[model samples]
Target chain A: MKNLKLIIQREYLSRVKKKSFIITTLITPLAIGLFIFVLGFILSYSDSEKKTIAVVDHSGIFNKPADLAKSGNTSFELVDATVEELKANFEDTNFDAILYIPEIKNLYAQSHTIFFYSEKSPSLDLEMVLSNRVKNKIRNFKIKELNLNQKELDALNTSVDLDPEPISDTAKDKSKHTNAVAAGLGGFMGFIMYLTVFIYGMMVLRSVMEEKTNRIVEVMISSVKPFELMLGKIIGVGGVGLTQLAVWAILIPIIQIIASMFWGIDTSDINQLSMDQAGIDQEDVMGEFSMIMSEIANQNWWSIIPLFLFYFLGGYLLYASMFAAVGSAIGDDMTEGQALTIPITIPVAIAFYIMIVTVQSPNSNLAIFSSIFPLFSPIVMPARLAFEPPIWQMILSIVVLIGTCLFFTWVAGRIYRIGILMYGKKASFKELFRWFFKQY
Target chain B: MNSILSVQQVSKHYGDYTAVNNISFELKPGQLFGLLGPNGAGKTSLIRMMTTITSIDEGSIFFNQEKINSDTPGLIGYMPEERGLYKKMKVGDQLLYLAQLKGLSKKDAKAKIQSWLDRFEINDWWNKEINELSKGMQQKIQFISTVVHEPKLLILDEPFSGLDPINTNLIKSEIFRLKEAGTTIIFSTHRMEQVEEICEEIMLVNKGRAILKGNLQEIRNQYKKNLYEITLDQSPADLSNLPGNIQEQVDNQIIIHLEDDAMSNEILSFFTKQGIRIRSFKEILPSLNEIFIQSVEEVEA
Candidate 1:
């Protein structure tokens, strides 16, 4: 027990003290924030360049140039010129493009193809804005010709706001808004779990390979059991993973708070700036934002956080032990390591894909089975947790996951005991199986 | 006195291939015992079993008159032939970790590491990573890590392989000092001369079997052929009908091989009757290297 503790301490401290670990832990959140900021900035400014379009209309629907509306960066003006003349000399004039509206034989036609001639193609946003304006004008003309009541027509358009509530008396009350928030949270948690498993599990593998290739395993085995060494390493790397997660959780919010205090550059400020620049209604965005915040507040975090931690640890242990075994099996050949690692990574990658699907259909048969399956549950089950998966399913999944973790860890210990000391020869999957059954 | 370690017919096998075959040996307290064997002669296998890194297939091993088990590792120090230390770890931290793994408390490990670093006069190297140190410096650290816990039995395999002569002597003296402090030392190497100088009792293993075992001097005496070299004052006029067969003669000295029943006095009397002055006479015993090769070849044959 003391040896195990020492091994774990050495494994944990050695990695935690590395310059790379410190730099990465400190810099990643800032880099992500900077990236989001730059992206939003670029999106708001991408269409800032203004352009003028000259319209030669013969359809008489848009009778006056003053009735034509300007949207965003594109402005429209009526020109008293023929289509041929505008097309021939549109670039010579100040206008960026010439729009020709041909005479329509039927005002109530299902579709009308208009012509836009320019040296460069118009932006999709500009095209959509122009079409919507013309469609609205024609609709008004028809409405006036038909003598339709605008008030009655406006009142006739109805939208259904769905409130999904459980019919069962035992089921907890969950609003649709809360469900949306839960799905988003579940996705984020699942993604974090996936990243934790891959990053930290690979860390365990590299550490094991380092000890094996360095031939330190011989000395280490002489002092402690291989099982102790393996378990210590898995737990140690897992601790590093938890430490990194905790630091990020605390650091990102603190950094945001500091940035807002110093520069008034919080996320909401950026969102507001981008929304204003894009001509979106601030009230709608703020309303949605507050709704999301309230829904997040309404979540049962006391249960969710613990479940997230449980799945994260369970998934990490399951994969990290297998990774350690692969590391031990690998000799000096790097290609062999890659070959051995593929089996472990394939399931993780598949589980990530299944998680994406599970978020969309939380109660699907595929989601239920995968969430219950030990290999996929760590990722898929957490994604379904927010939807309040049946309590029995969660319990079964947790039990299976824990049992499988113990089983794999034992198997890995067996392989590792023989593999670490077995050098020169690259081990195959068959050989690992043999070692698993071989007595030491 | 009861032996500190006793291996009674211990064996190890890998599938159909036998690594160690019914090998038995004992080490007395404070004895510098040599485990001599050629490469692939099961020296490492036997050591692994002794250290409890691998289980014995047959027979039993006892340490301090108690049956060997998991706890026996804590009482044994092992430095494998393949020397290794964590390259990115500081020397002081690495030694402390290894010592702690061997059942030393953190405080004790720290104190012992500090004392060892001070004794080696490398106190400044406490914070330096193993990779930054020279090979000899790393070797010294490896040695310190092995002995920091102060086990009752110390097993060193090719301990001086990478050491410079100066560091080699330093480690050698420390090893001697440890043995003098009543630690039974197993010095395993194929280097015959060093074994001859350091080991009092030795076992020669070939093809996974002990072909020779006893005190070093006694073994040498047992393998000695009745051969003698005599330095004469002058060359003999005729060499016919000598008491012994002349193996080699150069100038005034002659080496003779005698029958098992022959006496040395006969040759001396024959020389005196020949009116030749005899300066000195001594028996010649075979070197350990010759005996090792001969025994191994015999086994192979």
Candidate 2:
């Protein structure tokens, strides 16, 4: 234990103090900041409106209607001029181009020749408004000749419908309609964790492979056990990864705050809009949040946190130990190690992919089992936590994950003990299994 | 002197192929022992086992008569053939860390590393990253780190592989100085000349076994052919009755390779009869390189 601590300190400081490690830690965060900063600028700038349209009513037919243009991101101007006068002033570059609706004998025939021009293409909204204006002008003229009252016209423009709602515990937050959406987001985060572990865990493998291939591990194993060396390296590099994660965690929130300041998003407006758009109420968000939080708060966390930490840490160690062993087994050089990394990482990769597709249905036998299974638990458990799950199932999953860690730890250690001293020949799976089972 | 290390018939077998086959050797306190072999001769495997970097299959190793196992590996320093220090780590930092791993406290490690750097005239390199230094300089840093804890045994494998003459001498002197301070060394190299100059005892291994092992002088003598080079004012006369045959004739010397333990009187009498002034007469010893080649060849044949 004392020796292991010494090795850990050495591994941590040597790696953390390295110029490459420091440079990467600083560079990664800076890049993410630059990316977000640039992306925000582009999004806000691109959303501002471009060309404007001018409207003209020739037949006095649009006199008593609501104003056709709203002044928000878009602007519309009404031009009080006759067709001849507007056409004569066409050389003016102030307006992109003009829309002229000449007085017509047959509205439908004349409407076919509707004019819409701009310095470039006009907006779809502007064209729709222009067409609506022409329709109204002709309709009013027709109505004026028949002497139809405003009440009669109003009565003819409306329709009726009926809708009923179902009541449930999830109904309140369901109004905002994101509890299910929250499940989807949970799935997304699970996928991200899966991918992150896979990516950086392989980095652990490669680091082991590199040191082993170069025979550096031979010197290291002199004063340290193969297990200590493996633990120290995984933890040391794992600390580097955690440092990166902490930076991202801190930076992302800061970016979100900065972004929110520049682009204001009103909850009421978004909720109301979604409600009107989706025909669901906005208050369901409240019900859904409580449901999700209550579910999260009720988990068997004493069991899960330990199991999760075990699986999270143990899974990495188990795989990384085997990776280190494999690296040691490849005594030649780096090219063979590079070629071997793919197969070494395949198990972790499979766990990640399986965790991703199964997160939404965590209690779905697959996710639960994978969460309990040691090889997949590093990914599966975190993902399963996102959805509401039964306590016994969480316990079972956790038990399985713990068992998995213990099982693989021994297996990996056996391989590592034998593998760390081997050289000059590449080890295969069959031989490795043989080594693992070989008695002392 | 006390024995600092002992290897008793230790053999390392890898699946049926024995890397080190029953090679027994020991290093006494302050003794600089050399392990010689050609490429693939298992010198590294033996060193690895001695340093506890690799396990042995057939026998036990002892550190100061305490059987060496996991409990006592810290007492040995192993500088492998391959460069093991993290390249991107600063010299002082890496040295300190590795020293700490070898059981030194931070304060002591720092102090020791500083003095070593100063002694090597590489105080400026302390802050530089390992990768930033030239190979010789890196070797120096590695050497410093290897000895930082002042272990009971120090093992170096091809320690001069990439060094220039000046740097090589610097390292060589430091190694001698370490030995003078009572450190036992198991030095492994293919460079036989180094062994000839510094090593008192040597074990030459080939094909995974010890082909020759003894005092360096004795081993050299074992390969001796009693060859002699003599310079005379004129060719020695009475040649028809000389006991030993003259092998070759140079402008000023007669080269004789003796096949028997005969008295030089016969040769001396012939030289006197011819009235030749014998300028020089001496037997040349076999070089380690010649002995190594001949041994390998004899085994092959």
Candidate 3:
């Protein structure tokens, strides 16, 4: 036990004190902060871009139209010039594009050709604005020729909104309203968790390989038990990864505040404009934002945090041990290491893919099976938490994850003890199996 | 005195290949014992088994008259032939870490490490990374880490394989000092001169078995071939009919193997009777190297 402590101390201090460790730990959060700040800045900048258009209406339609004056990011000006004249003067007047509506000889006879000219590819929003105005005006004329009344037209233009809810009685009330934002957040968290486990698990693998290649394991084995050494290393490096993640989590909100200050962005103005465009009232948006925020604030972290930690650590330990065993089993070279780590890596990749699928269909039978399966549970369970699984399922998944982690640790310990000393021999499946059953 | 280490018919096998067959030897406290063998002759396997790095398939090893096991690591200082030390680790800190693992308190480990660094004249390298040092310099650190805990038994495999003459003498003197201070030492090497210099008892393992084992002086004496070398003042006239067969004759000296019933005096008297003056006469004892080769060949045959 004392030796295990010493081993853990050595492993932890040696890595934590590395220049690479400090640099990576600090750089990752700064990078993420920079990324989020840039994204927010771009969204607001593009939101404020407005364009003016010159429209030449030869069909005598929309010339004196009262309702088709200005839209959100687009406004029109009637130009009493030929297409050539308007094209030449559009750039001088800061007109983004010139829309030429050629005269229709017979309104019911054939289609009229319209052309839009610009110095560059027109923005999709600008195209949408012009096309919708022109299409509506033409349709109105077509309706008038048919002698349709305004009430019938209004009834024909009605739009329907959908509100999707889960059918489960337990979730009917809680999940009465589903939003894209919440689903996206759950998926993003799941992905970040997978990346953390992978990066740190590989760190454990590389450390073990280095010890073996340097021949340090021979000296170390004499001082401590193999199991103690492996456990110490896993815990030590895991702690470093955990520290990096914790710092990232804490620094994100601070970075958001700093970015808000630096950019001088007024969220209220952006929210008000968005609300006006969407025809939503201020109260409704505020209620949605506060509901989302409180849902986040009141998340049962007492349960979720522990479950996240359990899966996060359990998954890493399970994979890291096998990786260490592979490190010890393979010859001291990158090619052999790569070949051997493939088997271990495949499972992790499968689990991550299954996690993505689970985010889409949390209540699906496949998701349930994967979340309970030991190999996939670390990733799938955390993602499914937003869906709120049954208590029994959570307990079973946690138990299986912990159980598999412990079992693999023991098996890995056995392989590591024997393999650390074996060199120059390529370890085949048969050979590895023999090692597993070999008495120490 | 009680034996510090006793191995009785210990064996280790991997699959069908037996690395160390039924080998047995014992050494009393304060004795420097040499474990001699050629390459692939199981010297390292035997050492590994004794250190508990490898499991014994048959029989057992006792330290201080008690069976050795996992807990015996703290009592043994093992320097494997592979010469392993964390290359990126600083000398002082690495030594302290290894010593602490061997059951020394941090304070004790620090003090011991300091004194060892001072003794090795490497005080300036205390904070230098191991890879920054030359091979021989790193070797000195490895040796220090091995003995820093002042273990009761020191097992050194190829301790002098990479050392210069100066460093070799330094380590040899330390071995003598440790033995004098009542620490049992197992020195494994194929080199015979150093083994003969320090080892009070020795075992020659061949084909994973101990081919010859006894006190160093006794083994040499037992392998003596009744051979003698003598220098004469004048050349003897054709020693064909001499009392013993001449192995070689060079310059004024002749090497002869006496007949089983004959003695060295008989040859000396025969030369004297021939009106020749006897300048030097001495019996030649076989070296450990010679016995090692002959025994290995015999076992192979």
Candidate 4:
């Protein structure tokens, strides 16, 4: 145990002191911040400028003047002119497009013809506002023609909107579905977990491959047992990975805060924040905004954090051991270890796919099953546990993951014991299974 | 009286292929024992078994009568045929890390590492990364890491292959220094001169078995062809009375080869009768390489 600690400490220090580690840890967060800022800026500017369409009202019924500003961020304009007059100078290009609705033969034609100077997909905001203004003008003309009272006119024009309420409330875990902030956060964390494991796991593999290629493992094995050397390397590289991660974890928030405070970011801008605009409120927007912010603040990171560390550390060790085993068995360089990478990587990649699809659907069966699988659990379970996961499932997943880690450690130990000594032969599945069965 | 390591009938196999057949030997304290063999002769397998690199297929290995496993390897130092120091790691840090692995405290590891670096005239190399060093220089760093704990048993395989003359001498002297300091060394090499120079005992393995194992001098003597070299007055021309094939005749020396390892009284008397004044007479000893080849060839025949 003491030796293992020594190994871990050495591994940690060697990497922590490296120039590359320091540079990468500090630069990545800055890049991410810049990406978010540039993307937000582009989106908001595009959404702010609503498309404008000029209407040529040929019929006397086109009397309602278009408003510059509507209820929300939408507007319309109307012109008193004939279709031919508007069409002659439509290329003047002040409006996004000029719409012509010729007097319909029956006034009840199922289709209306619209044309623009150039081909383009019509903007949805422009389409909605144009249809509403035309309908309003017709409705007012009809009211006057019938000489209906205001109450009857409202009754004739206004349509009832029915909102169906489900018999059951699915918002049982109010925190789970309100916004995908937790899920986004979970996905972000999952990306981090997966990336670091892959990078440093490959580092361990390379370290072994280099030593073997250099023929140094032959000597080191004499002083240290294959398992000790294998464990030492895994623990060492993991320590390096952990140190870099811990540094990033601590530093990124600091950097983000500095950047955010320097530049004012409007949280309520849907275009800026990439939020769904359908549920947006005109007056009570601040209420929804604060609810989200408060929910983010109230997250019980204390519980989720320890679980994150546990899974991250366990996942690193488990994967690194296999890397070392296959790395030594291959007896050459990085290219040879690639064959070993497929088996190691496929499960984690599958888990990443699951994390991306089901973070919002934590209750989905795919997420549930993946969260319990040891190989995938390192990424999935912690994400699910960020919100409230069932206590039984959490415990069960951890137990299963820990058991799997132990079993793999032993299996890696066997391969390492056999593989470290056998050289010039690529690690074959038949040999590996044979080695596993021929336990001494 | 205490042997530091004992290998008892250790055999190793790779599925159906036998890599090392049954072989056994004991190493005593303060003795430099040579393990001699050719490539693919299972010398490395035996060394790996002793070093806990591979488990014996049919036998046991002990350090001071205690079984050698991961925990007990601290008592042994191993310098493999190929040097294994981390090339990217700073020399001092690499030494300290390896030293600490052998259970040394940080302060002790540093101090010992510093002493070793200073002793090796490589104090300037402390901050130097290993990749910056020559292969011979890298070999020195590995050699230091191997015995940094001052282990009771040191196993070195081809410890001299890559060194230039000066570095080789420095290491050879240091190895003797280690043995004098009570470190039992199991030296493995194809270099016959090194074995003859340092080893008090040896075990020659070929085809996975110990063809010969015993005192280096005793083995040589026991397998001796009893050849003798005599340089007498050149004026005495009647030397044909001596019955043996003449192996060679250099200016003042005549090498009389023998058919068997027998006493030389007959030749001594014949030369004394010729009234030939003797210049010098000494037994022509068999070299370890010669004995190694002879032993393996005998096995084949």
Candidate 5:
């Protein structure tokens, strides 16, 4: 136990003292800050400029000038002008586009005759906004011509937007539709989990390879048991990874806050963005944002954080042991490491790919299968946690993951005991298996 | 004399091929023991088993009559044939780390490492990375780490393979010094001259088995073929009738293998009887190199 501790200290300190580790730990948060800043800037700048359109409506359907559809970034002016005149004056005017409607008695006939002219191809946003407004007016006109009461039609429209109410006793929370936030956060967490596991596991693998190639492992094994040395390394490097993540977790938020303070990123801009996207007013957007903030504040972080750590450590050890085995098995070259690592890496890659499936359907069969599987659970289970999966599944996943880690660690240690001293020969699966079963 | 380590019929096999087959030997405390073997002769296997890098397959090993198990590794210092240290680690740090792994406390490791570096006259290289040092310098660091913990048993495989003459002598003196300080040393190598120079006891292994084992001088005497060299002041008119069969004749000297019934004194008297003035007479015991080759060949035959 003492030897394991010393070995862990050596492995951890040696890596943590590296210039690369220091540089990356300090630089990653800055990069993330820059990324968020750029993203926010882009979001605010999208569709900021207003465009005017001259509407020459020959159909006279939109006769009420006050009833014309207008938004903050788009406005329409009714003009009595021919298409030829409008086209000739299009470039000289401040108007961005000209919308022409030829003479028609009905909506079906107007569809073919309506023309929109612009200096360049029209933006999809502009096209969507104009077409939806025109369609709504036509629908209202058709209803009125049918002798339908407008208030009754509006009531029918209101009834179609049915919002289901939750039962008083069984429902966990007030929010029924948290899929949007869950998908975003869950996807982000799973991806980062996969990436960190992969990065740190590969570090352990390379570290073993370095020791073997350097021939230091012989000396090391003479002092400490191979299993002890390998376990120490896996835990030590995992600790380094966790430290980096912990630092990033703490630093990024602080950096983001500092950046927001220095750069004056107000919530109004975010509200404006939401308003533009949903075509809702500022008050509705403000209400939605607060509800989201409250939901975030009420999250069960105590459970979520420990679970995240469990998956992270479990997944890391599982892959790191396999990597260590490969490191022990391979000769001096990295080619064998690459080839062998593929088998270990595929499960992680598959787990990440299934994260999207988890987001789409949290209780999906594929999501449950992956979460239950030890290899994929380290990534999949945490993602499913965002949807508040049944407690049983979490327990099963954690238990299976821990069991798999223990099994692989033993197998890897067996191979390592012999492989570290083996030189000159390229390792084969047959030989590795023999080592696996060989008694010490 | 107290035997520090004893191997009782230990054997290791890989599939059908035996790596170290039923080989046994003993080392006295502070003995400079030589382990001589040809390529793939299982010297490395025995050394590894002794140092706990690999476990015994069919037998047991003991240190001070106590069975050598996992806990015995901390008492053994092993330097593998292929010298290895973390190349990116500083000399001082690497040594200290290895010493600690061998069960030295941090403070003791640091002090021992300092003393070792100073003894090697490499104190200035304490902060230099391993790759930045020359091969010989790196070897010095490797040697230091091996003994920095002051283990009871030290195993060095091909310790002087890549060292220059000066470094080799330096390592030799260090080995002698360690022996004087009561460290049982196992020196495994293909070099025979070194065995003669320092080894008090030796074992010759071939094909995973010990073929010869004894004190160095005793083994030499046991393998001796009664060969003698007689230096004459002048060439004899007739080169016949020497008591021994002539092996080679150089100017003013004759090398002969004495017949089983003949003696060195008889050869000298025969030379004097032939009126050839003898300048010097000497008996030549087979060198360890010659004995090793002969014994391996005999076993092979």
Candidate 6:
């Protein structure tokens, strides 16, 4: 036990003290801040270039164009000219383009196509704006000619929002709005879990390979058991992973504050501007944002956080042991390392893909089975946690994951004990299997 | 004296191949022992079993008369043929880690590491990374790491392979110092001259079996043929009718192979009868190199 602790201390401190670790930990948040700043800068300047379009409505319905709905960066002006004359002398005019609306013989036609003539193609936004304004004017004229009450017709249109609520006693308190929030949060959690497993699992693999290639394993194993060395490394690297995550969790918000103070890029202001452009009410958006926030606040985080951590650690250990085995089996040949790593990575990749599907339909049979299966549960189960997967499924998943982790660690320990000593020969899957089963 | 370490019919097999077959030996405390073997001759396998890095397939190993187990590793210091330290780690930190792994407390490890560095006159190298040092310097550090914990038994495999003459002498003095302080040392190498100079007892292994072992001088004497070298004051005119077969004649010295019935006194008297003054006469024994090769070849044949 003391040897294990010493090994863990060496492994942890050696890595944590590296300059590369410190640099990466501090630079990642700054990089993210820089990216956001650039994005905001581009978005605020995207529509600064203005364009003018001359409207020649021969149908005379748009005689008063001042009342037409206007889009940002574009304005429409009524003109008294034929399409042919405008096309011939468009450069002579100050307008960027000419919108020609032909005279309509039947006002109740199903559809009408208008032409916008210019040397260059008109922007899609400008086209949509002009077409919508014309369409609304024609509709209003039709309503007036038919003697229809606009207020009553507007009232007749109805929208239905079907909010589902589970009748089960366990899920009696869950709301549809909460379910939406859960889906988003669950998918994010699953993605984070996937990244953690891949990144830290690979770290363990490379650390093992370093020891083997450096010829340090023999000296190390002489003092401590191979199993202790491996376990200590896994736990130690896991600690580093946790440290990095904690640092990021704290640094990202602090970086965002400093960035906002410097550039004055108020995200909420951007949201408000977009909302105003979309013709949405400020009160409606604020109400929706608060409801989502409240839904997040009302969640059972005590259970969810602990369960997430369990799955995160469980999945990391399971894959990390397999990676360590492959690292030991690989003797100088990196191509062989890749071949051995494929088997371990395939399951992780598959779990991530299934997580995407599981979040969409949390109650599907595939989701239920995969959530309970030990291999995929680390990712899939957490994805369904916010959706409140059945209590039994979560418990079974945790139990199976822990059991598999222990089994793999044992098996990997066997392979490592032999692999670290065997050199000059590339180990195939057959060789690893033989080592795994060989008596010690 | 009780044996510090004893191996009894220990064996290790890798699938169909036998690495160490029924090998047994014992080492007295404070003895500088040599474990000599050719490449792939099961020397490493035997050392690993003794160090508890691998299990004994068929027999048992006892350290200080207690059956070897996990705790035995703390009492043994092993430096493998292929040995290295973490290149990115500082000398002091790396040595401290290795010492702590051998069951030393942190404070003791730190103090021992500092004293070792001061002894080596490399106190400034405590903060230097292993990669920044030259190969000979790294070798010195590796040797220090092995002995810092001060184990009862030290096993060094090819410890002098990469060292320069100066560094080799430095490590050699340290090995002697440790042995003088009552540490049993097992020096494994195929280099015979060093063994002849340093080792008191020796074991020669070939093809996973011990072909020769015992006190170094006794083994040499046992393998010596009936050969003798004689040096006269001058070269004799009539060299014919000598009692033994002449092996080689160089100036005043003559090396002859004697038959079973012939004697060295008889050869001296013959030179005296020929009116030649005899200056020196001695029997010639084989060197450890010749004995090692001949034994291995005899086993092969």
Best by DockQ: 6
- lDDT for model 3 comes to 0.82
lDDT-better candidate, 1 vs 6: 6
A1-440 per-residue lDDT for model 3 (tens digits): 99888888888889889898888877877786677666656555543557677787887677565634877666778878888886666556777777888776665754656789877777665666666667667778767766878787788875555666558867644423343434555577678778977898888888888888887887888888878888999988888888778887887777767766776655565677556545567996788788677667655668777778888899889888988788778748778678778887787889889888888888899899999999888888888887678999998988988889999999998888888888788876667778888976
Chain B TM, every candidate: 0.90, 0.90, 0.91, 0.91, 0.92, 0.92
Which residue ranges in model 4 land beyond 4 Å of their true spot?
A45-193, A239-245, A250-254, A263-267, A270-285, A297-302, A356-361, A364-367, A386-389, B56-62, B65-71, B226-244, B247-255, B258-283
Worst 10 residues of 2 chain B by lDDT: B234-243
What TM-score, computed on C-alpha atoms, does each candidate reach?
Answer: 0.91, 0.81, 0.88, 0.81, 0.88, 0.93
Can you give the lDDT of residue A91 in candidate 2? 71
Model 6, A39: alpha-carbon shift in Å?
A: 3.3
What lDDT does candidate 3 reach at residue A65? Answer: 56
lDDT of 1 by residue, B1-301 (tens): 9999999998899888898999999999999999998889899999999999888899999999999988999999999997699999988888888988888888988998999989999999988989999889888999998998999999999998988899989999999999999999999998888898899999999878999999999999888888999999999988896888999999999999988635788888888999999999989988899999888788778
Tens-place lDDT digits, model 2, residues A355-394: 7667545557777677667677666676666454567876
Give the Å error, residue B152, model 6: 1.3
Give me the iRMSD of candidate 2, please. Answer: 2.7
Better of 1 and 2 by TM-score: 1
**True-vs-predicted CA distance for residue A288, candidate 6, Å:** 2.2
Candidate 6 residue lDDT tens string, A1-440: 88888878878888888999999999999999998788778666545667788888877678554645467877778888887887788778888888888877676787987888877786655566677778877777778767899999999988676677668878566555777898888899999989999999999999998899999999999999999999999999998988998899899999988998899997666787677557678997898789889999987899999999899899999999999999999967788799899999998899999999988999999999988888798888889999888888888888899999999999999999989888887789999999998876
lDDT of 2: 0.70
Q: Which of candidates 2 and 6 is the stronger one according to TM-score?
A: 6
The local lDDT score (0 to 100) that residue B38 gets in candidate 5 is: 83
Tens digit of lDDT per residue, candidate 4, span A69-159?
A: 4524444467776657666776775666666655534444445554433246556645555565556555565566667687865677654
The candidate that achieves the highest lDDT relative to the unseen native structure: 6
Q: Ten-residue segment with the worst summed lDDT in candidate 2 chain A?
A: A171-180
User: Which ranges in model 2 have alpha carbons more than 4 Å from their true place?
Assistant: A14-52, A56-65, A70-89, A92-119, A124-178, A262-311, A326-339, A344-356, A359-362, A416-440, B234-243, B257-262, B265-275, B293-301
> What's the DockQ for every one of the candidates?
0.79, 0.51, 0.68, 0.50, 0.67, 0.84
In model 2, what is the error at residue A107, expressed in angstroms?
14
From the highest lDDT down, the ranking of the candidates is: 6, 1, 5, 3, 4, 2
Better of 3 and 6 by DockQ: 6
Q: Which residue runs does candidate 1 get wrong by more than 4 Å?
A: A48-50, A55-76, A81-93, A102-105, A253-286, B230-237, B241-243, B250-253, B259-282, B296-301
Off by over 4 Å in 5: A43-156, A159-173, A178-185, A264-271, A274-278, A364-369, B231-243, B259-281
What would the per-residue lDDT of candidate 3 be over residues B135-236, giving only the tens digit for each residue?
Answer: 889888888989999989999999998899988999889988898898899999988877988888999887788999989998887889988889988777
Q: What stretches of model 6 exceed 4 Å from their correct place?
A: A63-70, A83-92, A168-171, A257-261, A266-283, B230-235, B241-243, B250-253, B259-283, B297-301
